[model samples]
Target: MPPTDGTPSDTDVRASTGKKRIPKACNPCRHSKVKCDEQRPSCTRCQTLKKTCIYVEKPKTAEEQKIEDLEQEVLVLRQQLQTQRDTESSIVVSQPQRLMGQRPPEITSPDSNASLNHSSPTWTSDKPLKRKRSHFRMQKEVAVPDFINEGILSEPQALHYFNSFFEGCDRYVPIFDGSDGFAAVRLRSSLLLNAICAVGCGISGDASVDSRILHVRLKRWLTTVILSTHAQSLETVQALLVMACWMPERSLILAIATRMAVELQLDDAFDRLVNLSISRPDTPETHILMKSARTWFLLLNLEQILQVDAGNLVDLRIKGVRRCRTLLNRPFSSRLDARLFSQVELNRLRAKVNETLTSHSDDLLQAVQEARVDIDVWYQDWKRIMEASPLSESELPSLIANLTVQRHWAEAMAACRAVRATGVHQVEMMSPEAHDMLVIAKEALQNHLYVMLSQPHYLANFRYAMDFVWAKCAFSFLLLLKLTILLPDVARQDLLGQGRALLNELTKSSGYGSSKVYLRLLQLTIKKYASRDQTHSGELDAFIPEEFIFEWDFPGLNLFSSPTGWDMLFDQYMIGDDLFVGMDI
Candidate 1:
């Protein structure tokens, strides 16, 4: 009954093991170590362990042991090479420099050459050092172009050629210490001549061929030399900026030059030059250049708004608005001072700019908008003062009020638009102030509207109060809807409604409208109730507020009594109502 499945047992296994014999060698050799297999020059055992494998007698002395060690090292290295060959392809080894018979130069003192004569042992005496004739032979010399060269046919051509003439002289200019004024003056005259030529060509429309050439020459001179050398002087920088402004591609040039002037603390000089140009009566070029400067200034100011730390944003906004006002008020008339105005017609043209301040209110609005502060109250107060002032026009206050409302509406719209523009792509979206405002506004309006629409008992009363409580909401909603249509497909959902359609038709017919607060409210309501359960109250409970179930509207009282009241209602209906509903009452 030994093992039912097999015949062989432990006795047979023991008899087989008793017949095996152990090898009389080192454990490594008996285990068939890879190193022990190396039998040529050295045994694999010694080679694997990196030990000397002397086939003959072992070394008797230290010196002999050292020699044996070196031999073993060589053998091990050769074995390594063989192993590497088995694993990887062989690489071509470069011959050593020593084997090529080339000796590298020795380090010597520089003065050693001067002290050692050709006859000395350290020197090569075989050849007498022929007096080392100057190795500083001039290569091909480039001729400098003369400003008044006879070879050049026209004064413009001569000036154009001379612009590059001083280019080589840049190396000699003491740019760091300060420019050599005399040298700069000569250079300036040459450049100025070229600029004058280009202007002349532009004026005559005949020098068109050389005008571009002159412009390039002048630009190179200003950017490379004049601006670089005399950058300390705002006047010089302004002049360069002015010159660059004359070219078709002026914005980039003006930006660079203005930034340079700003960095150099020559803002006053820059402003002065701009003011002079703007104030110039006779020069159209100067007037246009001033506008370019103003644009640059606006850009700088806009950049500063982003960097604003702790300051009254209201004050900053007022300052910005005032600055724009001042710019608009600056006389553009050519009739008064010919130096201040470009021409008689331009001075006559200046009469039209009395209304420029009104148009520039957009710029003021833009600045205020960027500040992200509430200016509605301030704007209202200012409007009153502006209306009462003899200098202010009758339409100005209404215009300002309209702009202020638009600004607020735009801010809210920007938030909603941002969500569609950004987040829908499965990426993390930055929740900006605008986005938060829209979210709060939308949610509040939506929640309130859903309550109002869902309650059948309040529908009659709601309609009665809708005209007063929801007018503002209706106006804002309409405005928002109009803006939403301008947005891409993804954000159009936020602008949905019958109110929007009604307003659209109205706007088309009457050519005027109010805000879209009400429209957004209606959309929010639809969004809320559309998801509710018609069969059960469970889903509806989540959207409809608990307070909405109770009859809370008080006639002739504040319509915004509901916790989620007319603010939400007006956002949707553009009307204010005096219906008060208290939880306790």
Candidate 2:
């Protein structure tokens, strides 16, 4: 948000160095060489003198200004495309009068459902269907107007969703760097814009667009566009990766996405970016190249997770990638690059743990110990870097710190599962390793919740809130659910109470779409078993947490392995294709 400085601002706040936080001076103060009490609509001197106060407007972040520019460009392009279609078809289209002058609804999109009203402009469809009149025959035709509603919705709803995503999610994941800022750049960039709209719609938690139907249409369109495209582009790969996060629950889409990423040489792009970083300064090309690393690393991270869950080999091989080794060691040019570099390193640690546990059971214990040390070192280094930078001023620093804590927790859980899977019959409930693992999970959940609650401001931004919040909620619930069964009655009740509070917070209060339904599903799952005597009997069989960490897909979560299924509930949402099942993993 650019600050308006027509007057003095809040000059009271000062940094530790005694520098005024509001440094911008009024024009009168600047000319008189007097210290201006950077105030609001007017400064103290301006108020006293009855003179006009003019302050320099604070510059907007490149990410924001750029997106706004792109949005404008997209709008222009849409209008031109509309005109072109009309010209080609030899028919001019006219918009309805009601829509021409009406103000669009305010759109606020986040990755998950938080800080959102239960209803949004996106949820309600007020437009009447239009029938296309044929030239020769009086045939009626209804087009798929819904296809680009997000793109062309009068208030530019897609712009809101797009900006919201960059604000909340892209900072954590830098797929959309401002290097490609112009509307022209966006226009030429294949499915990038459309894919962004798709993810925005998915995470916005708006029910206005039929997600199930749009999911199919978007996937089909994405596939069709990519297949016919003769060129591979960073935008296409970036979009596919975004969808991997947006629609993660779909295994087949991920498989196909993995293939698309490979075909686009995302890894090779990472390699090129690494060399470019060392060979050149932070020029335009280098900046873009670095962003491609973020895209590639994200793909590797998701692919690794899916592979671990499926017990298949993730096709990406980063170890041999020359840039993989040097990218982290080099000085980061931007916050996005630094954050992405940290994620790549973290995912590498995860992949190591998963690969060892699955491929070499004989070495699981040894490997887990080593991986723990590696992750700790990585976390410490990244923590230091984060503290050293301006990121400390933002929620990202702690948000990621909590994520790191959670990742370690997932590692502990996987280690516990590995111990059991590796025929550790000697390990009893009272065994030190088992107890240690349980405590680790408990501590992780506590710290994760602490971080989340500590930063209410971050969670308040519903647009980007969904992914991180959703992941945290899902992971915490499962951990607490597991602990509910594992702990003694008093301790179990305490954990259960917390779990209930968490569910109630989202289900009863949160107004975002799907949150109530999702939380209710969790509550019912707990209810179905919370009362059974067998549940509190220290039965370990009832507590298999999803081993794959960092999974928050709407279609994925499954509870109650008790023959009864939650498929009926989930079937209401979630859409995907299954043609890529046999793809090489």
Candidate 3:
């Protein structure tokens, strides 16, 4: 069927666009703004985009309207033809109908095509297939070596090793034994071994060794010595305590050991001498030894208490006064004066004891009452000593410096003042060793004041101590500096002055080695201050020797890691929000 006119038919034009135009009843391509060639079913644009080719009803142009009507008629004819073909195919396939009961053929209308498009893909496979077998290689077993022999040592060998390693050492001599003591030793040794073993346990890196066992051993040792009551065991306990006190990084251990010593009433032995007649006229040597022993005990007591409860400043001061009174009661031979009557010595002792009431406990009301009773007594004693064969003014500075080393700050200050009152600056100057003693005393007083100031109850006493020490150290340093610079023959007369000059010269000439030893005392004092206040950051820059700070390999410092030392210092120093903001360091 060619067209009557010479023009090509609409079907031929539709094939070029790969689309078909439809009637007004169903023309989705026209509404979708795609080119619709006049065909019955599918459109080119939907096919190209792989979208569902849907036919929806729409109005069409006159020419398109004619083509659409023809398409509907053609569709009806195709449906009839498909029905006839299906009937014929069924008849041919079922020629011997008796083999099975004849069944009617299922009818599918032209509209069924739309229903088929909506259905999902079938799940059944067309053919059945067998799976292939996979082969796996077997792994060989590994044999592990037995470690039982290495794991545990025999008891006798262990004991021999332990004794050989620990018995001769002053710090770890064994003093206890029971059924369990051997086991305790083994346990402690095992802990040490474990710590060593842990270092090698990790495959790729060193592991942290647990120090808890070591801490526990120290704690138990402290407890045993402190709580032991046997008189026979006191010597061993005392030895252990002394050793424990000397252990590095063991402040807590020392504190506990000291407490144990106090619990065992060892301090009472020293206190007992105050009541004894060791100062009898016939036994001057015994008196001296007793005095020395008492002094030693007092200092030890003070040191132990200071180590434990440094924050309890008022209690320490009170305890110090009580100890002083106890010492005063026992008159040393040195104080008797060979020419003085025994009664005079007794009277002087009474007066000295009375004078102690003035400095009683740093309490305001108590101090006032005690001062009125004691000031005259002290004044008389001072007058007697001053008038009768007084020490040379030149000797006072050296005496004071020695007293400072003995932890007698008040006596040292008095000696310094006495030397100063004589208008003899050159003799009053401190040598380098004397300077070191002065620094120690100054640091102790400052530490005492710092602790006192921290407590609200001791504020007034704190101020007094602070003012006294600050003025004393400042005046002494200034005097030393002035004398070192101004006095002729200073280097020959004063070792400390010469040391200072040497240090100055070294700094100027870049001689670091000689300066470092001299600067160590100052550096230690600075370290104490830093630890006290937790402020060691830039404060050490000026005090620590440049060579020591830069050249020495500080223990526990990791050079590869980012700087954590400074950060830790900042955390330790800053107390509260007051110093939190704008902290550049």
Candidate 4:
């Protein structure tokens, strides 16, 4: 069988193999129990028959078969488990409807297991929610622990507090639209509801209900439930926003709320809707989205105000201010929208002044002057809005009065910063800007004081006596005092008396809890100033005492804690007399 050539014969190769094994047969051959070469394209028998060539898989062994069965069983078991979960979810969802005739089980806390079923239904339902119970609202209905069910938070007292908020404080902040009344708040978030009540307690003069208990419980709930759970929602942001405006932990709360807002993309929602040309739906959900957009606007506005208050340029862009105004003009907006819009616009101008003051450019004075022009234009535009009579006799006259006061306050602040831009050293040698600052400051103080005194009822409201107003009063007082001390001839002495009267009225206002502290510190500073003789003033450095020249803080607020504590006043008097003897004002 061997070939003559070097190539080996098939029989010789087969013989060299000790035991030649036949290949596994293809499907056709295996059915007939015939041998196969295991060729891919065609078996020899199938090719001869001109039939389709097909190969079958090898049979699994006993162990492999057992493993395959186990895998199939696991897959079936997983599917069964999913089915069971779905059934349980359906039962839980239907249980509330099934017991519609009977009272549902009471929810002991916001974390109760039953509340999980309410989220999807509450948000997706298109029907008016007056008839239905929302998750938070339902939980609120049931009496909870002492913390949530006592004092101002109790059901009996909660309405009065909420009413006080809506009537007194809501006009200033304008967070709630007052469409569904308190239901809009209670249904949305228990935390937000509590925050609203706590803020309302500041204005609500209810003696029977102690506000201290409500405040303590709210703080507990904020830290333990909402913050610890890392809850994120539009309601939570609103709650945090409300708290930041009134709470002592303003900066920290604002930071956290703003971070959550970014995570929620609240600032982007309006632009996204506009870009996509998505028609807003006439549903509760759309209303919520619009409110969120407005919330973002208010957040933007307050952030800018705080930055300007701290004497720093706002890091956020001004476009949000514009967008917020547009959003406020949308349907469901309130008459108070104009007030908030005016504030945003005013703060925008203040931000520009702050930017110019912080810059080191040589044309800083010109830039500040230009900024002042814009501020003046703002006053001219909003003045009519501020002066227009309220549409209804029931509308709070203080709303317009407060806006007017804020406008004057904004102008004074702008002028004060402009004076800083002029780099003035002495009040005796005044530049155009310094003279303007003196006039504006005095006029603003007189205007606001007249408003407060002529309508002394304005002092009874929380908005008139809150921290910002108190700060304005304290700042105006200090500025006037310094000016009078520095230039007895140029500045009016009666302006100081007017400033003192304003502080006295503020202290007399029952709603301002910290007015005493504000007035007391100011009085001590004035006392210190009077103890020193300004008549012998060869140099203006000794006009203001060293203690009054630095950062000043109240008990709860860092009111005058800005590094530029005296701003232009610092340049004029805080420096050593040698540094500024020959400098031009």
Candidate 5:
């Protein structure tokens, strides 16, 4: 079957490449790029395609691969030679004569990958120090998603923890803008992300992250951020507010944040709010402005409370309703915002009342009347807000109600303190501010005790709420003690019984250790007085003990002795001083 001109049979057709006949690939199959398998006869592709298979005997070229192999060999030799040099240098540095006289110190090569800059301490010895690790560890290979910050959390984990914050905490304070860009910016800052997640874990009912570890990390970062030159970010201020609300032992942080906020002029940003047309609700720029505004207000909200309780003059004196109404008319007027506005106003008045009480003016009566007028106006405005744009009774609203009642009772107590002094046993003969003090103090003290004793479970709120309520309760008890004999028979016995019950409950309760001490003081004082009064001739004849000195705690603080006009320093020192040293603000 061979062709006439010495050609091979049909199976050998189309198999030539240049001068060589191809053996491994059939010409047709090789052109189509399928496997030829180099079988003795026909390969699978050649058989399937019914084409000719050819064989070539020339060797293929491997020059480029040979050069790559040589390069790799040289690199390995260089590394080995460098390592040998390092070993020799180390050996020379640690001669046996040097080792014989004293113990040898561990020598580390400069090329070692151990962390040299980490502040976590390392104990140097013959053995490596062991470390205890819990759930979190830094995986150097893991990277955050493009928008997220570098380190500690992968994309999925960051998303998972952020949801906890949105669900639990954001309901009360709607500060975040909640857009995609906002989220990206939020996750991009490592300092802010740690703080936000710490607060989230602290509040989250279902969260498994160890909140204490994250909280400790936040405090460490806070030291670097707060005192740094770049501490002007609004999110940083917001995180501070969150910590001030939820964290225990926040006195130092709270003071630093307040000073930083004022230095940054966050309070002044309120006046420059853009018009609604310029700050459209959906725009990114508007969200930035709104967040700034909210940050300013939030600082005011927190600082007002702290300043009042700390016996400092109000740093923020903006009482005009027109500005808040202007803001409300623009892009921010939810019920939550309205309620916060009301509270900010109310707390400012509280600061003024606090100023009057702590102001040791020679004209004390004049100061009291001025403070009383301001307080009456504050109450009127609160009533106005309630009737006009009343918020629904959410959990925060109920807490605000409790705060209002405490403020009312506190103002009454302060007003009576300006008028008179009397022994604990003597009040009925002349009723000046003396009688009013007993009545006001008794209501605040007696009612708080009875209600708390009856419920016994209301102390389980976040630390902010419980701190406020307990302080009010303690102040009430101390006021009644100052005029214990002046109290109605019913009030005295009720406090005695309820105080004992509270002490017993606190023994099993997770309340502050400070509260336990405060209640015991009250209970012990009442026991001594009650036992003596039982053995005395007349109510007035029982001599009040001088040992029963009045001392009580304010909210979130240790016991504050009676005020002696420390607020005057605010006027003297803070008039025009700027504490910003190297900071841009």
Candidate 6:
């Protein structure tokens, strides 16, 4: 059996061991009893003979099977744990609908017929089993009635509204920054999509459903679903801010949105980003950081303006409000950024003026001079940006610049009103304050006339939902009406005629409810004056109600402020006062 050279021969060794050859051979090679070389796909013999080669695997051992089953079970447990974690993160809890005196929205599950626990011991039992459900449901349950399904806005009509929003509404709001386009927005948040459509419907005036009704429906859905769940989402904040700017219940909705943003830590991010020294790279995280930061800045700007418009003084001592200057000083910021900063500065100056006037300070003239100087300084600081080329996406620069100038004119009127308020009631026709007020009022009215004649769309369409726009126009008309009656000798007849013509046009063309009320007052006031002049020729003692003429608390009288002093006026004019209270449809 041993070889001659002290090694065994292959044939002698195999014969002595009595073993088969090539145990690892492929099926074809093994069947032929040939060496296989154990190649992955084929053996040398099979390749040479042109035959199909296949390998037969041995059965797995018991321990290996058990290990695989355990791994699959771990994977399933991990998925269930992740689901539980996600459910815990949301704000919704059990039976929240019952707390609101409403039933929970019903949703049908696709896996209704499948057993949730097939491994349970009672899987085949006929006895009833207790159903298990999540402690909270974060998914959207209240569905927005499809405007398209309701035949309010068709697909093409919705496209038109979307286009209108991107073209115009986005310029003012700028909330949808770095959006991936309409389809992506639609896929992400239907609440935001519907809010855009409703605001656009107000601007475009093309919807079959009344724009107010659309807004009401959207508000209902937002409160029922988004607010009820306390959804901590950036899209929810954006939708609320947009509605606050364009719809009723502005103050309350704005407060809620600001609170939500604070809760979401946007203010912290805003301060941090404003203080950062190095530039951030182009990443998704950077995009989100920039978006949240910019939204916070936008919210602050809106708050300042809203407070000033409501005749409330804003405390600029807040750190976040002060950061506006730091961001303004940042180089290479966008034109919109420049505009936003300038608005904040301008509104800040306006609040200062309101505070100075409301306090009845002794040095009123000096305070007015200081406020005017501050406003002019702000204008000079942003003058270059204001005159720069229009944005690539919009022509908002020119529009905003014009609006700033109009606001400046309104500010001047406010200053004049303050000066006149200090003078005597009798012999008021001869007072220098009266003359000064008339001069500024005439200029403001002429500017509005110019805008109406040249850029009708600005007033008629893009700004239809902005209450301040109508408020300013109404205030100017009221000033002209009251001043002409007081100073007939100094009244400019041509300006009065032009103001009446504009009011008539607005009454006919505008769809806002406030516009109709102010224009009707104009007609009624003219009739009152005419009838009084005919009956009492030179007796001007009881000509017009002293309160009506002198009271700054009346609606449409204060150009830049809402009426917060009179309950009757608020009740009669502020129709949407309760819109956001209980979120009633």
Per-residue C-alpha lDDT of model 5 across residues 13-79, encoded as one tens digit per residue? 4334244455555444555556667775767766676666555434434987788898997677557
For each candidate, give its TM-score against the true structure. 0.24, 0.58, 0.25, 0.61, 0.52, 0.59
Candidate with the larger TM-score of 3 and 4: 4
The better candidate by lDDT, 1 or 2, is 2
Instruction: Estimate the overall C-alpha local distance difference test score of candidate 2.
Output: 0.51
Please, what is the whole-model Cα lDDT of each candidate in the order they appear?
0.34, 0.51, 0.32, 0.56, 0.50, 0.54
lDDT of 6: 0.54
Q: Tens digits of per-residue lDDT for model 6 on 1-585? A: 333332334643463456444235565654555677888777676678777776544445699999999899767765664454455434222322321122333322232322222112121223466778879866555544546655667778767777777765565675455453667656655666778888777767674757788787787776764435434456667777878777657667777778777666566655445444245444344445555666776777677766655543434324535456554333324446655656666666666677676686465555655665766666665665555534422545455545555555644555554554555334333345445544555455555555664555554442444555455556555554544444444444565566656655665555443444445555544433433422222212212222234322222232222222322212322343321232211
For each candidate, how many residue pairs have backbone atoms clashing (under 3 Å)? 53, 12, 8, 0, 5, 0
Arrange candidates, best TM-score first: 4, 6, 2, 5, 3, 1
Q: Model 2, 271-354: lDDT tens per residue?
A: 566555666755555555556566777777666655544444545657753245355434444445556666666655666666
TM-score of 1: 0.24
Clashing pairs in 3: 20-39, 21-37, 21-38, 21-39, 25-57, 226-260, 431-496, 432-496
Name the top TM-score candidate.
4
Cand. 3 Cα-lDDT: 0.32
* TM-score result, candidate 6: 0.59
Would you list the clashing residue pairs of candidate 6? none
Off by over 4 Å in 6: 1-153, 178-180, 225-230, 275-277, 312-335, 389-397, 400-404, 420-457, 460-464, 487-491, 504-585
True-structure RMSD, every candidate:
28.2, 28.8, 35.0, 13.0, 27.4, 21.1
Where does candidate 1 stray beyond 4 Å?
Answer: 1-207, 226-232, 240-256, 268-422, 425-585
For model 3, the stretches where C-alpha displacement exceeds 4 angstroms are 1-254, 276-296, 299-301, 304-401, 404-585
* Model 4, span 1-585: residue lDDT tens: 333332334643463343554335555665555787768778888788665665433456799999999999767755664554456445512222211111223222222122212222221223334665556631223222332444435675777777877766665566566563776567646777788787677667677767666767767766543433234567778878887777666666777778777755577655643432246534444455556666776787778877777532336655645454454434545666666777877877777666666674465445645765776677666655545524312443755566667766666666566665565545556665567666665566556556766666666563424455555566656655554544345444455455556556665664534544456545554444545543443323423433223322211111121122232333423354433233221
